[model samples]
Target chain A: MITAERKPLDEILSYIKPFKRILLLGCNECVTVCAAGGRKEVGVLASGIQMSMLKNGASIEIREHTLERQCDPEYVEELVPIIDSADAVLSMACGCGVQQLATRFKDKPVFPAVNTKFMGGSDRHGVWTERCQGCGDCLLGVTGGICPIAKCAKQLMNGPCGGSVSGVCEIGDEVECAWHLIWERLKALGLTDQYLEIMPAKDWRAGGGSGPRKIVREDLAE
Target chain B: MKTQSNLEKVLSGGHLAVTSECGPPRGASAQTVVDKAKYLEGVVDAVNITDNQTAVVRMSSLAGSVLVKQQGMNPLLQMVTRDRNRLAMQADILGAYALGIDTMLCLSGDHTKFGDHAMAANVHDIDSIQLIQMVKGMRDEGKFQGGAEIKGVVPKMYIGAAANPFADPFELRVMRLAKKIAAGADFIQTQCIFNIEKFEKWMEGVRKMGLHEKCYILAGITPMKSVGAAKYMKNRVPGMDVPQELVDRMSGVAKEDQPAEGIKICLETMERLKEVEGVAGFHIMAIDWEEKVEEIVKQAGLYPRPQV
Candidate 1:
């Protein structure tokens, strides 16, 4: 899931200060799972903004709605009827969702309330850790399921660099060395032969190094 | 000989090789490199010029290597994966070879967090192992990493890589060395040896795997200048192992005699490592203390380096 955190209240307020009526949107997808831009968060933000505005001796109208998935065009179109009543659309979803709303409603100003951090999963309650870099090419099978592209600070492929000490990265103590985990896992699984083989230099073109990437599925196209 | 480099000739001639590091100055001072090279010229087989070692910005190792070459010394040009992508690396290899540097060391390099510029983004586009393979391919296959054949005068390099016996997952350190050797590392320069027992144990593994026979393994040595330097490496430096006893030994000595004690300890390590089978030679890393190289080399009985 893509994890995110709500932008500071001041930054969000500054974006919508010029508008009278604002449509506060939410996503039930990744942002919802991370509890950053769920329906509950939308309500919390709306009330916070209203109270803050009232304290400043001003009144503003905020209409709240949480879509099944703000990234999809069909779910975004659900706001067509009520979007006209609002001055601007303030999305509590990830960057993809905000862009979706902006693209769908051509003339409306779309503002993001939460900062999309990374494509990751929750480690525990209130803690999310990145697991993949979407490098397009995956070497997880060889690396014993640990993603070096995302986990290793230097993105080393063969093994850990000289800085890995006591299973910790040079970056910090909290960050465990990804290659250490790989080596341990491979040894336990009796697959040290896989670790012995040298991994080639990565072809980063698939990782969006060339440019923004797009996938076209002719079978699913209309 | 692979590249006809003096280090290669020495190692291939069945003699223990002596290599030492020469860190380029942070500022562009060719004279600094020349000054350091003079101390190491006849005392060592090759001078390992670092490429932005520890991620601090420094003179390009290629340029530093050329300056050392100008002084009639073999410069083991050290290139790190942390700074350059394959394109730039290969270009520099070609450029370095064209300018008369033939031996090179491939390293993953220290993280930028340890350097002055912590905010800099690192480019580990190719890890050190792949880099060794890339250099080998360029030399042996006469082809680029993309498989395009070179039109003329391909870079023929004697490739070297770093090894850390003290790093975690100790069981895999030898295997990692095996991968590097398989990837075409002609020689191996290990991290500094403060913990000799662990290093001997690692060499036992190396001998068990018979990797020592395949590549020349140069033991790294860095003499402590002070007690504070010893403790700092023990606490702050990553992958560095400075046993408490060594630190205690340094502190036990008088303040004025610490540097002498440090060199004495270093010479003792060299004497011990000299007897270890499969131990190729030494890589004395007297960083910023180049003048000490001649004394250290002479005192260790490795002076009057073998003329290959």
Candidate 2:
């Protein structure tokens, strides 16, 4: 799921300060699963903004709404009535959702209330870690199911990068070395021979190198 | 001849090539760079100019390299992937080359959180390995990263990269060095080494792979000025492996004599490392104690770098 965290109160407050009526938009897809931009977060953010505005003796109204998925145009069109009544829309979704809302509501000033972090799943309740870099090329099979592109600090194709100590990354103790985990998994699987096979240089153009990417589906296109 | 850089000549000549670092001043002044270069002159083959090392804002390495060149010393400009994207980096490579700078060290710089500018946005458009490959392509193929042909001469530089023998999963260090060498790094300068035993173990791995023969390998050495300095590196610096015994050695000494003792430890490390099978040279990173480099080199009997 796409994960994110709410922007700081001050930064969010500054974005909506000029507007009198604001809509706190949330997404029910990835952001909801990640607990970042969801119905619950929308209510909490609305109440916090209201309290902050009240303390400042400023008159501001914030309405909360959650779409099934903001990335879809059909779900985004559902926001027309509330968005028409609001002066600005603060999206509590990932960057994709925010851009979707902005594209659908061209006249309304749409702003991001949360910073989209990465594409990852929760390791446990209330704890999320990055598991993929959307490198556009997958090597999990060769890597013993570990994603070195996202997990390794240097994204080394064949490495623990001289910075892995005791299975932990040099970046910090909290981060585990991706290659260390790969090596252990490979050893357990009796594929230790593959460890000596050198990985060739990555073709970054397949990743996020050339520019913004797009996918074309001939079967689904109108 | 790797574009005629003196450091390249020394390393290719099979001498124990000596290189040292000279950080650019925090303020806009060329005097500090010139003065520091003087300390390294004749004692080392070349001087590495750090690029906003530790993420602190300072005089740019490109500008500082030009200043070092003016002093008749070769400058190994350190380029980090943290600040600029491919366009700026490629342009700077061309500009630096045009200015007669013939060597560069590719690095994924220290995170900005470690510096005063903690809030600065980092741009890691490419990592150091890619940077090495890109520079190699530019030099050998005369093409940009996107395959655009350069209309004029390409930057011909002796490519360099860093390694950390202390950082863990210790067995993989040599493999990583091999990767860098495969990516076109002509030389390798390691992080500060305080644990000689650990470093030699790493060197043994490198020799097993015969990687030292693929590229020049220089062991990094930073002389600790005091016990406080030793503690600071052990506690604060990431990936720095300062063995507890060295700290004890410094702590056992009188406060006033710690500096000399620090020099002795460095001298000893160089002497012992000289015997390591794959070791090709010493990269002295005195870090504000540049004055001690000459003595360290002389006492270690590595002075009079062969005039190639």
Candidate 3:
């Protein structure tokens, strides 16, 4: 899931301060589950902004709305009617959703109310941890379902660097050494031989090293 | 003669080679490297020029190696995967070789979090093992990592890699060393040896696999300057196994005598490691205390380093 956190109240306040009216938009996707850019968060932000503005002896109009998905054009079209009533649109979604709003409402300014963090999932109640980097290709099959590219600090392919100590990374105690996890998993599965093999240099071309990537699903294309 | 590096010649000549580390200054000071090179000039076969060790920005290892080489000492250029991608790494290898650096140590350097630049992005395009293979390919096959032909003058380097016997999943450490050797690492320099018992066990595994015959294995030694240094490494430093006994020994001495006690412990470890099977040489990392290296080397009976 694409996780995010709301931008600071001050930064969001600064953006909407220039406009008399703005739409506070939220997403029902990953941000919702993470308690970041859901409908409730939109209501909370709307009230905060209104109160902050009223304390300054001025009040601005705010329209609150939450989309089923902000990154999709079909769902973004639902804002076509209400978007014109506001001076600008402040999106509380990931970068994809923010960009989608920007592209859809070219005339009205679109400000992001939240900061897009990473493509991760909720670790526990309110905590989220990154799981994937979407590095076009995946090596999870060979790595016992662990992703070194996303987890390891050095992104090493061969094995753990010398920094792996007691299943922890040198960077911090909280961070688990990805290679250590791989070794343990492989050992448990009687696949220690796989851990011995050297993974070659990664081809970063697929991971956007070449440039922005695109895919055309020929089977689903008209 | 693979690049005719002095370190290579010493190891190949069945002589216990001596190599020490010299970290480049954070600022651009060629004289600093020259000064450090003086202490290690006749004391060791090669001096390893660290590349932004601990992630702190410093004068590049290539330039430092050149400076050390100019001072009439062989420089072992250390390259880390944390800073540059394959293009920069390959380009720097060619550049370093052109500037007369023949020995290279490949490492996945300390993460940036440990360095001054914690916010910096790390570029690990190739791990240390692959870096070893790449350098060997450039030297032996005259090809780039991507298998393209080098138009002319491929870099010929005596490739080296690092090993840590104290790191966890101890059973796999020997296998990692084997993989490094198979990847074309001509020599292996281990992490600093504070826990000789663990290291000897690791060497036992190395001997079991007969990996000692495949590559030169240099035991890494660092002389602790104080009891604080020992305790810090024991508790804070990653993969360091500083036994409680060593810390107690250091603290038992007066503060003024701690430095000498530290050297004594280093000499004792080197003396013991010299008798261990599969141990090829000693890599003295006198970290900032380079002046102490000569005394350590001479007292260990490794003085008058073999002229290969």
The candidate maximizing lDDT is 1
Q: C-alpha displacement of B25 in model 1, angstroms? A: 1.7
- Taking the tens digit of each residue's C-alpha lDDT, what string does model 1 give over B174-264? 9899999999999999999999999999999999999999999999999998898899989988889999999999999998999999999
- Cα lDDT tens digits for candidate 3, A120-209: 877788888888899899999999888999999888888788878889988897899998999888988889888768788888899999
DockQ measured for candidate 2 = 0.38
Instruction: State every prediction's TM-score relative to the real structure.
Output: 0.96, 0.88, 0.99
Ranking of candidates on TM-score, top first: 3, 1, 2
User: What is the clash count of model 2?
Assistant: 3
**i-RMSD of model 2 (Å, 1 decimal):** 3.2
Best by TM-score: 3
Better model by lDDT: candidate 1 vs candidate 2: 1
lDDT of 2 by residue, A1-222 (tens): 899999999999999989999988999999999888999999999998999999999878888899999998999989776678999999998999899988888898999999999988889999999999898889998999999888976676666655566888766879999989998899889987676666655677778688989899999977
Error of 1 at B247 (Å): 0.6
Please report how far candidate 1 places residue B96 from its true position, in Å: 1.1
Better of 2 and 3 by lDDT: 3
Listed models, DockQ each = 0.84, 0.38, 0.84
Q: Worst ten-residue run, lDDT, model 3 chain B? A: B1-10
Candidate 3 per-residue C-alpha lDDT over B255-302 given as tens digits, one digit per residue, 9 for 90 to 100:
999999999999999999999988999999988899999999999999
Error of 1 at B104 (Å): 0.7
